[model samples]
Target: MAPLSDPAPRLARAAEAPALAALVERAYAPWVAVIGRRPAPMQDDYTARISAGQTWVVAVDGALAGAAVIEERPDCLWLDNVAVDPAHHGGGLGRALLRFVGREALRRGLPQVGLITNEKMARNIALYQRLGFEEVERREEHGFRRVEFRIAAAHLAG
Candidate 1:
C-alpha cells in the first residue's frame, strides 16, 4: 500500500459501526495481555456512539484504519478512545486523530481536551505525554488502574 498522506478523520456513519468496531478490536488486541483484559474500547457499542454523533473515523487507502470516540463534557472534550489498526501503526494516524481532538475541542469552545488510558500501557502514556498531554491523576476506575491526561486547547493552537 502507498504511504498515508495525513489522513483526515470524519464523523463516523452508523453503517460503519461494525467496521469501526473491528478496527478498534484489532487496534487494542495487543493490550489485552498487558492489561489482563479487553480494554474498554474493545467492548464499546460503536453503533450507540455513532448515533450519539461522538465517533470519528480515519481511512487509509480507502479502508477504515483508525477511529476516535469523544464526548463533549461541560468543561472539556473528553477523548474517550483513539485506535489505529495495528497494520497502520507508526504511520502518524494516531497523531492525526489526536490533533483532530484539539481542533474539535476548540471548535466546540472547550478549553481543554482530556483522555484516560490504562496505567499498565506505559507506551501509550508516554505517547500521550509526548503529544503534549499532561498527566492529571492516577486512580483505579471500573476495575482498571487509569491515568488521566489533559492539554489546554490553546496549547495546540497552530
Candidate 2:
C-alpha cells in the first residue's frame, strides 16, 4: 500500500472539479460492470457540489488522492460520494473520510451520519459495518438496489 497522507482534508475548490470527478470515476470504474451501468455518484455535478461547500479533498504529497461529498441534512450528515483513487486503495483513506464525516456530523449538531451503496457491493457494506454503521434499510430506487447505513453519535462514542 502507498504511504498515507498527513494533510487534513480541505474544502474542495471549484477549479478542482475535473480532477475530483476523474478520481471518482477511477475509483468506481470496477463497479460499472457489476452494477450494469454507471453509479449515480459517477454522474453527480461536482462543480455544483464544490460550489455549495459540500465537497472535501485529501491530498498526499500534494497530489489529490481521495475525495468525499457530504450533504448536511435536517437530522444527519449524508455521505453522498466517497472515492479514493484506485492506486491509493487499502491505505485507509476511505475510512479516514468516513471518520471525517462522523466528525462533521458531530460538529454540525447532527445526530448521525448516513450513506448508501449498491446492495451488491458486499465488501463496501461490510467495511461500513465494521466502522460502526448499521444497516438500516434496503430498497430499490433510481434503477439500483441500495442498502442504507447510518452511524449514530452514540455508536461513534462507543
Among the numbered candidates, top lDDT falls to: 1
lDDT of each: 0.88, 0.85
Which run of 10 residues does model 2 get worst, by summed lDDT? 1-10
The TM-score, computed over Cα atoms with residue i paired to residue i, of candidate 1 is 0.94
TM-score of each: 0.94, 0.92
> What lDDT is reached at residue 8 by model 1?
64
In candidate 2, which residue ranges exceed 4 Å CA deviation? 1-7, 154-158
Per-residue lDDT of candidate 1, residues 3-108 (tens digit): 4436667899988999999999899999999999999999999999999999998877667998989999999999999988999887777887787888889999
lDDT of 1: 0.88
Error of 1 at 63 (Å): 1.7
Give a tens-digit lDDT track for model 2, residues 10-100.
9998889998988989999999998889999899999999999999999777667998899999989999989999988887778777777
Error of 1 at 34 (Å): 0.2
Using TM-score as the measure, the top candidate is 1
